[model samples]
Target: MKEAIMIDLDGFYLEPVLVSIGAYGITPIYEKPEPPESEEADEAPELPEPILIGYRVAVPVPSGLFKPRYDLTTWKAALSAYDDAMDAYCAALAAYDPDSEDEPSQPPLQVDLRAFWIEGLTRQEIDNIRNAPSPKTDQQEIARLEQQSTISMLAITELFEMMLPIIMPEE
Candidate 1:
């Protein structure tokens, strides 16, 4: 069965009066207004009506639907873990060799994170890395750095396990 859906639009140059079924196509329709009558000969010409020349539309699509969907805890953990891993990985790279003739390429995590919003790490931490701050210590600080890396790695592993088979057939 098919359903007819109606949407009201505002602030448009052309309005959609009717849309075709199935394909859902619409054409622009504009209303013409009568000229204003002038009482005084010195009256200024009526301002041109704002033309409906162009329009923009936004559509939202659901990512997916699943049984036993991810809850708050799962989402939070995955986000935190991803962020933590990114932080540790970037930190390790930064401490490797800052002044060396060969500069290391930035990881996909860091490059993508800067473009999009994600959880984990404070704004200061992200900024510190983004701004190219000097590495405070050398490779000797491996233990402390390794601890964070370990935690991030384990967290990511747990997240992957949760995603392995997200849903099962109803028993």
Candidate 2:
């Protein structure tokens, strides 16, 4: 005779919250359109929704699923397993910044995802691991991304780090 088998793995994990901004400020050079004859000139466009999604960001796999079948290892066999739900969790996060650019020509405040892992894994290591879907990325690229995601309203240093050279207008 045979018996049934089931298992459960539970744990709390931190998700990345992308606080994003455009890399290069997009500038539009549109000429002012002709105004209506009777309507006011400076009336602003009426917006219906207060919030909008600017972009979709992909989330990195968590350390929980980093290895396969940890319980089967020689270490311990108390039926304890890594948080298996993280796969689905990460999948849901895959479409992080799924919003279209409002003005492709102008810089916009973008909503991006940055995972704050409950575990101690750093952004660099997570970026390097190769997965079935995407190829491996180097640490520098990961670092570059880290810099891009560090946009904070309270951090003035972030602006200075962007330090783009300015060209004086021709006399």
lDDT of each: 0.46, 0.35
Off by over 4 Å in 1: 1-70, 99-105, 108-171
Query: Which ranges of candidate 2 are over 4 A from the true structure?
Result: 1-45, 50-55, 65-115, 119-171
**Candidate 2 global lDDT:** 0.35
Q: Model 1 misses residue 15 by how many Å?
A: 28
lDDT of 2 by residue, 1-171 (tens): 221111112122223333234322111123344543546658765434333212122333344654322121221222122233444445555645558544223222222222222333455665667433664479878987778667554376655555533434346
Q: Provide the global lDDT of candidate 1 against the true structure.
A: 0.46
Residues 1-171, candidate 1, lDDT per residue (tens digit)?
Answer: 232222223322222233334432122234456667778889876855754433221211123211111122443455578788888778879787867887675653422211221233456766766798566676747877998999999999999878767755345
Best-fitting candidate, scored by lDDT: 1
In model 2, what lDDT does residue 164 have?
36
